[model samples]
Target: MSDLVSIPADAPTQGMEPNGWIVVGVPTNFFATASAHARSGPLLGAAAEVRFTPVGFRWDYGDGTSRTSASGGASWAALNLPEFSETSTSHVFEQPGTVSIGLVASYAAEYRFAGGEWRAVQGLVLVPTTPIIAIADRADTVLVAESCSINPSGPGC
Candidate 1:
């Protein structure tokens, strides 16, 4: 089996927001289940640190709240020789709504032990899921067919 990791965006569920919050990182993806009961349960838990030079990252809470952070040419090899870890800054949402999260990490290209030159690695984006309101006054649901189009092209002709 492959190892899985979970990252939680530390946000408030109730009461007033606090300054400087820390997010819990888990080894598995538990945001979907945990966030559902975040109001009553622990929002931040144990989380694994992600290793790699992160150039930048962005988060979009479907509720119309978003945030972004970036880093410049930081050398990790000097500290530990080609390895580094970074924890994201904490953010809180005043209102409850769906949230879409994205992340991007970059690594400086390095020549292999054999031979090569320095290069740059492309960034990455991860969209976990749209956060759903566990408890809401009113809920709306919509359904649609998997493979259906409003305007047909050939068969009828």
Candidate 2:
């Protein structure tokens, strides 16, 4: 996915100056790609191109865990994949649950350039629920009784 990035203000501006205001801009256009897979199964890929400066970025795979990466050249890794980078991580859900994956990118930092210092841009990703099921069977008397209490409105019931 490609998004247009914009810089943020360090603090709220109260009044307009005589000549309005002066704003600083930073270099945009960054590209990042992420791929996830079961250690032995299929792989899923996602990519994003930064259109502006971002201070921080995080990824939540909706498996009860999350990962984060910096927008700059900094790198991060996961335990399952030792040789991996920050933009990607491998995860496995312990049980069946609705997984809503997403990303949070924000302008939480300031940088100093040749001219001066300026705040960065930010973005986020919102993923819907993804069901993951693990099969198991257990016998419970309450459940059995509830199942046996049929409404008798249909043949199966």
Candidate 3:
């Protein structure tokens, strides 16, 4: 499966607060699925084919933090919740700057071809993790005397 398919690049990365805003200790999300294929070869013996499916992910938050998750993180809207209210994979940062985040997708494959019974692979295989993506977070300090509900103009609310 490793040689046949690569991890999808549509990994989720968003919910980041912009400059002048300080939203900390919040949950963000990411999502990626697997691709399937079956081709002709001796490996198949013209009697079998293979399918690779993403089972989970190991994530690097790039701030000396990492975690493994069973399901891809979802968007706030996808969960029908307000912004910053829910998450599947999340991180907390002490200070802010550019952070390098990455994901190593694990796959569980099965073989079924020529109308034969499906057989599961013994274990999971991981994709190469050399390539990674980065995100920037900003830190700001603001002094405000009013609340967003009352003032709706307070800084950093």
Give the number of the best model, judged by TM-score: 3
Ranking by TM-score: 3, 1, 2
Model 3 lowest lDDT segment of ten: 13-22
Model 1 weakest lDDT span, ten residues long: 26-35
Q: In candidate 3, which residue ranges exceed 4 Å CA deviation?
A: 1-25, 33-47, 128-132, 141-157
| Positional deviation of residue 115's Cα in model 1 after best superposition, in angstroms | 3.6
TM-score of 2: 0.27
Clash-forming residue pairs, model 3: none
- Estimate the overall C-alpha local distance difference test score of candidate 3: 0.54
True lDDT of residue 145, candidate 1: 35
Candidate 3 displacement at residue 30 in angstroms = 3.3
lDDT of each: 0.27, 0.29, 0.54
Give a tens-digit lDDT track for model 3, residues 41-154: 334334346666667777786778888887766554566554445466655555556666667877776776676887786777665354345444543654567667886534
Ranking by lDDT: 3, 2, 1
lDDT score at residue 157, model 2, on the 0-100 scale: 34
Enumerate clash totals for all models, in the order shown: 8, 1, 0
Off by over 4 Å in 2: 1-52, 71-88, 108-157
